[model samples]
Structures are given as structure tokens and as C-alpha cells.
Target: MFFVTVDEKVKDAGPDDLIMEIPKLGTKIVCPTYFLVLPYEDFDYQDEDEDYLPERKYSVAIVLNFWKHTVRKMKDNETRYLPLLFHEVGMGCFKVIKEKNELRMAFGFTDDFAGDGLNIDRDSLEDFSKSVQSIDVLTMSACSPRIFQVTRKSDNPDEPVVSFNISIDECIQDVNNSRNKLR
Candidate 1:
């Protein structure tokens, strides 16, 4: 009677019927994640933190609104702590603090200097742009279908306090569309 001995080389290998070298499949996002990036000018986080970042006094703050499903994945799968994981990306992210109720808050961008109460320059586009671009925390965030709401005081004679809202979605869409300009 001939008997075969157990081979030590393949001890760890089990189920000869199964295919060897089966690689783990990577997951693909069928529904692509998207964000809305809002630019905030003259953003401030903390007084002492000003010198911490060398970029400048002003920076672009990024605000992102994500799909609820995406948020769940980030929380459950990512294992990111709630306190550390930021659902939105921006200095004006009052929602985050409010949701957490931690009493921590950061100043956000406005049409003008918030405390000074001075209206933004008539043609302060450059200052505003630079400020938005300079945002320390959210400067590098990406977005799709970006939208912006700008507030401006009305020039009506009768109304002492009137503000108008403007939508900058077109500008954002243009940027997204022309991401790769051929010319």
C-alpha cells in the first residue's frame, strides 16, 4: 500500500478547487461623489493662529454639501471620528459646530470686513479672489456644480436696510466646463 505524506510547503494553502491568486476587487463609486465649493473672503479662524500659517491674512474658504449616503460611508466605513471628520469644508461652516454643539466657532468671510462694518470695495474682485484663494483649511478643496451667493445692499431710497442676492453658479459651471481649455 502506497501512502502520500502531507506536504509542508502547501500547508497554508486550502481548497485546491478554488482559484489561486484571487485578488481583492477594488470598489468603484457608481454614483460619483460631488461637492459645492463656495469662496469666502477675509476668512479668520483664530487670532493666535494667524501667524501659524504663512499664506496671508485672507484666504478662500471652501464649503461643501455632500449627499447623505456619502456621509454615511465616510462615517461608518472611514471610521473617522465625528469630532475630527468635517462634513463640510469651509470657515463659514457654522453647521458643523452647531451640529456638534461644542461651542467652538470660527469667523467667516463677508462682503466687507465684518467688525469694521466697512462695505467691500466697489471693485474688490481681486481682494475677494485672493482672499478666497488664501483660505488655509479649505484652500485645496474640489467641487462640482459650484454655486455662490453674494449679498449687496440695495440702493433704494425708501428702504434703509435692503440686500440683494446673486447667484454665481454660472461662473462655477463655466470653470468646471472649461477645466481643460484647448486654447
Candidate 2:
């Protein structure tokens, strides 16, 4: 498991200038007042001597930060939602959207990754994408242990193929509550 530590320089900075540093990865992520951290695991593969080797690894947590003014603008536009960020990873990308009342997230994987052991349900994925809630609860649930789990839905439960147990509603709720508190 990896850990996050705050940089000392951030202490002297203003609210809009917080910096988060992950010592293990020697990486620093800048935030514009509001942010959330979500953990995910990715795999690396290598081919040698006509043999394929897959290595499952833990990568740095995904840090999502948003500007306060941007969110305010989103709220003012009742019929539209703002796309905050699109973060690409080893096998796929994560898209974060901010609506007038909630936050939405979508995860997409490459065709190659899908052909591997990952099995995603299209209907569930769509529902997850549409579900909206408070961001504070969402972030808190994501950070909490066991809130998100990998479950196998195939007839052979012993199979390594699995899907992520996503509770998008909870995540949104948490985020909303946190944002309100900050305000």
C-alpha cells in the first residue's frame, strides 16, 4: 500500500495553492482549493521468448482537483455540466464531470485491456456513469476500506476475471457534503 504526505511548502501557501506529494512515487500534484483521491490498481505485461507475463501492480492514487470558480460556473449553468478532467492511465482513462448539482465519473478501458481478464458489464457501467450524488461521500467511500471491491460475476466464481463494485451515488454524496462544508 502506498501513502501520501503533504509537502512542507504547502503550509505557507494560500488555500488555492495546496500541493500533495507522494514520496514513494516522487511525484507532486497541485490542487486548486478542492480535491479528491481515488486508489486503483493496474497491471503491466511483458512478452519474452514467445511467452506472456502479466504483473499486477499498485500505482499511485488518482488525485482529482478542481478550481472553485469553475465549479461555481458549472452551478450557474443549470442545463450543462463541465468536464473537469480526463486522466489516462496504463490501460484506460478516467473522466470526471461536474454537473450543476453533483459530480459524475466514467471509466473506460482499451480494447486490449478488455480482451484480457477484465469483464465489464455495459449496462452497469452506463448506470454507474449516470448516477449522481455528493462528492464528499463519494470520496470518503472510495478511501474507506471494503467500500469498493472486485467481484466475479461469471458462472465460475473462481475465475480471475472480475468487475469493480462501484457505488457512484455514494461517492457523489460524499463529495457534495464536503464541498458544502468547505463553503
Candidate 3:
């Protein structure tokens, strides 16, 4: 068998690069590194025994689906599809904003995460939110964007609203890929 490494920074694999399997490739996992801390009284959680605890125990997470173009041979011809690739290189947190039918997402780099390399303070976060209105989500044929907003009782206007959304098509494709892997 042959192996190839899709560049670590690449979010989408081109058609030619998608058909082969990458041998000895280590698994890549990406998850939210920081969660906004709201008032403890606003959060809730249950234990394994189904008993409610005094303090909240769960945190938030953001998931993004990355895709790669692949072509497969059929009896008479070939078909192309943008398949979901579970690689960390193309996934991260995004700040989502919605005005009407469209949802805008700006990449949230790790550098700006709280207490991180380029930690963002309160004033900086507000400025960041204002700047995001002009940005647009990159359109992809295989994925559809959806956004859901969350608000906390004590949340102020300057505080960022946390939400989660993903490319439904890519998510479904990922599920199918996982099933195929099992077989």
C-alpha cells in the first residue's frame, strides 16, 4: 500500500490526494481549549446517579467539520465527493454571527484564547466582535452552515455569545465514513 501526508495545514484535500490512505498517520484531535466562565449559579449538571450537583460540572465545546475531495470509480464512470476528514489541521473554534438567513464565522485562533499566547482581554474581545461583521464564511459545496445562539442571564453586551454550528453535509458524511471504517 502507498501512503501520503496531506499537508498539516491543509483544510481540504484535492481530488488526487483524497483517494489514497495515509499509512502510519497518527490520529489528530482538536477540541475547545477554553470555555467562557459564566456565573456558577446559571449552569447545571447531573451525576451518574441522576442526582443534581450543587455546582455545574459541564463545559462547552465547538466542533468543526473539514472536507476533502475524493473520486471513486464506478462500473461505468467515476464520482466525486467532498468527504469529511477528521483531522485537526482544519478544525477550530469560530465566532458565529447571524443577521438573517446567513451566518458569519470568523476563525478563532489559539493565539488569542484567554490566558494563552496572545490572550485577549475584555476590551479587545469587544473590538474583535465589532470587526467580525464585515467577514464572511467561506462557501463550500459539501457543507451547509447552521448557527445556534446561547445567552446567559448575567451576560453583558460586551461578552461574546457562545454558539455551535457545523456543515450538516460534512457531519453526515463523517458518520458514513465512520460506519465504513467499522466494516
Candidate 4:
């Protein structure tokens, strides 16, 4: 029994390169799953009390249905999805925007997260969000440690896919961490 890596494709064309296939090679344990924190949008808006203040922004995370793309996961059933690969809920593909400095330590994927590697972007995350809001991902227990966005091929709910996003930060972090450990 040999091992292999399957680079699966997303639904149609929206979530591509973000992993959609994984044959499990041979003698593998549970199917490998993936999750990514793609480009997060910045919602720079003032509350009702609009005072001349600093630019305080909140995060908008759009979870892609990579782990068994399902429209139902976005609207209802925050938990428990039949089609979903991992029988869990919360933090699917949703647009995420948060302050750069206020990265909350609190994490949600720690629970029932039958996946590995919280892949992220390595480049200008802020700029990526401004120019492009989102991409697509399969999240189908095969999404490699990378970034992606969700998009619909057609206005109709039938067509959709995920695309890849070159994450510079992730790369840097990977390298830096490896270097530190080696030292």
C-alpha cells in the first residue's frame, strides 16, 4: 500500500486549486481535511455616534463550502450538515474582516475540527481584500494547506467553485517556524 496526494477541485470553477480531491492513497487514517483564512474584508464604518475617531474595523469571514459545498450550511443549520464531510458546524465560507492589530486569540475551529493546518495568506492580506473580496474553496477533507475564495459560476445556485490565493504570510511563517525550530 502506497500513499498519494489528490488535489481535488472545488464545486465547479469558483473554488479551484483549493483542493477538491483526495483518493486517500493507501493505508491512510481519516480523510485529510483542510481549512483556510482567506482574504478578510475591512468594514470601516462609524456607529450611530459618529465621532471623529480612528479607523476601527471589524472582520467579515466568508467560509467556503469546500468540505462538501452546501448552500444549506450558510443559511440554516449552523451545526450538523449531512453532505458536509466532517459532521460539525460553525465558520464555513464567509467573508471575514478584522483589525490587523486586534487579532483575537480566541479560536472556533479548535472544536470538532477534524482537519489540519489553518492555512492563511502570506502576502498583503489588506490589499487582497480591498481589490478582491473573496474566492472559493472545497473544504472537502482535501483542501491543502493553502488559501482560496468562493465564487458562483452562474447566478443560479447550481454553479459555484473555489479559486486559489497565493498566501505570502503562510509561506513566511512556515519558513520562519521551521528555521527557528532547526536553530
lDDT of each: 0.20, 0.26, 0.25, 0.23
Per residue, candidate 3 scores C-alpha lDDT tens digits across 1-183 of 112122222222212111223122221212222122122344332322322111111111111111111111111222112211212223223444333323332323222223322112334333333333232222222121222122233224343322233343433454345334323
Among all windows of 10 consecutive residues in model 2, the one with the lowest summed lDDT is 51-60
Tens digit of lDDT per residue, candidate 4, span 1-183?
111122232211122322222122211212213222122232222223432111101010111212112221223212221111221232233232222311111101212232322223322222222233223333324333233322223343332222222132432343333233222
TM-score of each: 0.15, 0.21, 0.21, 0.17
Q: Cα lDDT for residue 73, model 1?
A: 33
C-alpha root-mean-square deviation, each candidate: 25.5, 16.2, 18.8, 18.6
- List model 1 lDDT by residue over 1-183, tens digit each: 001111222222121111111012111101101111112243333343333121211111111111111122332112111111111332221111112211222212222233322112223322332243222122112211132221223343233111111122322333233222211
Which candidate wins on lDDT? 2
Tell me how far the alpha carbon of residue 67 in candidate 2 is from the true structure, in angstroms, after superposition. 11
The residue-level lDDT of candidate 3 at 80 comes to 15
Q: Judged by lDDT against the true structure, how good is candidate 2? A: 0.26
What candidate 4 gets wrong by more than 4 Å, as runs, is: 1-47, 51-89, 92-156, 159-161, 165-183
Is 1 or 2 the stronger prediction by TM-score?
Answer: 2
Clash counts per candidate, in order, are: 6, 18, 0, 41
